[model samples]
Target: MKNFKEKFKLKLAENNYKFTRQREIIVETILENENWHFNAEDLFAAVKEKDSEIGMATIYRTLELLEKLDLIHILDFNDDSRVYELYLKDHHHHHLICKGCGKLVEFSDQGIDYFEKELEDKYDFSIDEHKLRFYGYCGDCRDK
Candidate 1:
C-alpha cells in the first residue's frame, strides 16, 4: 500500500493533478481489491461504504482520469456496462466472463504469448497488449 501510495502520488504529480483525500480514498479502495473489476456504480458504492462524502460524479471523473493516466484499463464484456482494472506492469492476463450471472474469472496462459508473437510475425504489426474474453454460463448457471 505504501508503494502504491507513492506511485499514485507520483502519477498524479506527473499529470499535474492534485492528490486529495477523496482521490486517495478512491485509489485505496481499488488497491484494497487488486483483482476485482469495478464499474462506476459499484466503485461508488464501495467508496461510499468507506466514506459517504464521495459522489458518483467524482468516482466517474476519477476513473476517467485514471484511465487517461494509464494507471487503469476499461473492459467491456459485450455487455453495456464498463468495468475497470488496474494496470500492473507485466501482469497481463485474460478473462472468462459468465454471460448469465455476469461473473468473471481471470486466467493466464503462456501459449498466448507465443500466439501474439506469431500474430506479430504473420501480420507484421507489433502487439502491445491484448485482452481476450470467453463468454459462457458459469457452473451454477449452467446447472440451473
Candidate 2:
C-alpha cells in the first residue's frame, strides 16, 4: 500500500498534478483491490465510502487520466460498460471471459506469442500490442 501511494505521488508530481485526497483514495482503492474489474460507476461507489464528497465525474476523469498515464488498463468486452484493471508493469497477459457469468481469467502462453511473432514476420509488419479475449462458458456454467 505504501509503495502504491508513493508511486501515485511520484506519478502525480511527474505530471505536475496535485495529489488531492480524492485521487489518493481512488488510487489506493484500485491498488488494494487488484482482482476487481471495476467500471467507473462501481469505482465511484467504492471511493465514495472513503470520501463522500468525491463525485462520479471526478472518478471518471481520474480513471481516464490514470489510463493515459499507463497506470491502469481499460477493457472493452463488447459490453455496455467498460472495465478497468491496474496495469501490472512487466506482466503481459490476455483474458478468457466467461460469457455466462461474466468472469474473466488471465492467461499467458508461449505458443500464442510464437504464433503472433510468426504472423508478424510473414506479413512484414511489426506487432506492437494486441488484445485477445476468448469468450466461452466457464466450468460452473457448463456444469449447470
Candidate 3:
C-alpha cells in the first residue's frame, strides 16, 4: 500500500495544486479513519477534534480536490446526500447497502470478472470502470 501522505503530495504536484497545511491535515484525518464512510460534514467534525481552526468550507474544498485526483470515491445513493470513501487503488470491491439500517458491506465476486469479459467480447467494447451497489435489508436489519 502506498503512503497516503506521499501519494497525496504526488497527486497535488501532478495537478499543479498547492500542498497546503490544511490539505495535509484533511488527508491525514481521512487516511486515519479507514472504516469511516464519511461526508464532508463528518470529515469536518473529525478534523475539528484535532484542529479547531479548520472550517467546514475548507473540508469540502479539500474533498473536491481529492475527488478530482481519484484518491477517493464519492457516492450518491439517491438519498440527496453524498458519501465518500478512500480509493484504495488495486483493491476493488462493491458495496452491499442495507436499506433498513443504512449499513454498507464491502464484498467482491469472482463472477464479476467473467461477466465483464463476456460483455467486452460480445459488445466489442472495453469496460474501464464499473460500480456495483446492492440495496436490501442486511441480516441484522432483517432480524430487527
Candidate 4:
C-alpha cells in the first residue's frame, strides 16, 4: 500500500497535480479493497465510512484522475454501472460475467496469445491490450 501511495505521489507530481487529503482517502479506500471491483457510488459509500466530509464529486474526480494515471481500470459489463479495479501488470486478467446474477469472476489464460496473433496477422493490426468477457451462468447459478 505504501508503494502504491508513493507511485501515486510520483504520478501526481508528473501530472502537475497536488495530492490532496480527499484524494488520499479515495486512493486508500481503493487500495483497501484491491480485490473488489466497485463503481463510484460503491466507492463513495466505503470512503464515506472512513471520511464523512468527503463529497461524491471528489470521488468521481479522483476516479478520473486515477484512471488517467493508469493506476486503475474502468470496466463496463454492458450495465449502467461501471466498475473499477487496480491496474497491476502482474494481475492482468479478464472477466467472466454471470448473466444470472451479475457476478463477475476473474480469469487468466495464455490461450489468448494465439488468438491475438491470428487477429494481428489477419487484419495487419498491432494490438497493445485486449479486454475479453464471456457471459454465462456461474456454477452457483447454473444449478438454479
Candidate 5:
C-alpha cells in the first residue's frame, strides 16, 4: 500500500495535482478494498466511514484523476453505472456478470493471449489492451 501511495502521489505531481488529505483517504480506502468492484457511490459510502467530510464531488473528482492516470480501470457492464478496479497489469482478468442479479465475477485470462495473438496477426494491428465481459444468469438466478 505504501508503494501504491507513493506511485499515486508521483502521478498526481506529474499531472500538477496535489495529493490532498481527501484524496489520500480515498486512495487508502480503495487500496484496502483491493478486491472490490465499486462505483463512485460505493466509494463514497466507504470513504465516508473513514472521513465524513469527504464530499461526493471529491470522490468523483479523485476517481476521474485515478482513471486518467491509468491507476484504475473503469468498467462499463451496461448496467447504467460504471465500476472500478485497480489496474494491475500482471493480474489482468475479465468479468462474468450476472445480468439477473448484477453480480460480478472475475476470471483468469488463460486462453486470451492466444486469441489476442491470432487477432493481431490476422488484422496486422498491435493490441495494447482488451476487455472481455460475458453476461448471463448466475446459478441462483438461472434456476429461478
Candidate 6:
C-alpha cells in the first residue's frame, strides 16, 4: 500500500496540489480498506475515528480530487448517493444489488470481454470501459 500512497502523492504533485496531512489520512484510510464502497459521509466518519479535526468539507474536496485524478471510481447505484472505490485495473467486477434487502454481491467479468468485442465490431467503436449493475432480490429476500 506504500506504493499506492506514493502514486497518489505523485499524482497530487503533478497536478500542483499538496498532499496535506488531512489528505494523507484520507488516502491512507481508503487504501487500508480495499473493498470499501462508501460515500463522503461514510468516509468522514472513518476518518474522524483517526483524526477528529478532519471535517466533511475536507472529505468532499479530497474525494473530488481523487475522482478528478482517476484514482477512484464513483458508483451511482441510482439511490441518490455516490459510492466510491479504488480504480484498480486488474480488479474488475460488477455489482448485483438486492433491492429488497439492500445487499451487494460482486460478480467477476467472466463473459463481458466477448460482449465488448461484439459491440466494438458492430459499431466500429473502441471500447474503453464499462460499468454493469444487476438489481433484484437475493435468495433470502426472494423467499421472504
Q: List pairs with backbone clashes in candidate 2.
A: none
Ranked by lDDT from best down, the candidates are 5, 4, 6, 1, 3, 2
Candidate 1 has an lDDT of: 0.87
- Number of clashing residue pairs in every model? 0, 0, 0, 0, 0, 0
Residue-level lDDT of model 1, residues 1-144, one tens digit each, is: 577678878989988999999999999998887575878887888899999999998999999988898888889776789988887776788999998899888998999989999999999999876778899999999999
Please give the RMSD to the true structure for each candidate, in Å: 1.5, 1.9, 1.5, 1.8, 1.4, 1.6
Model 2: per-residue Cα lDDT at residue 136: 98
For model 3, how does the per-residue alpha-carbon lDDT over 52-96 read when each residue is reduced to its tens digit? 999988998899888899888898788867889988876788998
Candidate 4 pairs with clashing backbones? none
| Candidate 1: Cα lDDT at 68 | 91
TM-score of each: 0.92, 0.87, 0.92, 0.88, 0.92, 0.90
The C-alpha local distance difference test score for the whole of candidate 5 amounts to 0.90
User: Which is the leading candidate under lDDT?
Assistant: 5
Higher-scoring candidate on lDDT, 1 or 2 = 1
- lDDT of each candidate versus the true structure: 0.87, 0.85, 0.87, 0.89, 0.90, 0.88
- Candidate 6 differs from the real structure by a C-alpha RMSD in angstroms, to one decimal, of 1.6
* Superposed model 2: Cα runs more than 4 Å off: 1-5
Please give, for residues 96-141, the per-residue lDDT of candidate 5 as tens digits: 9999989889998658989999999999999998888899999999
lDDT of 3: 0.87
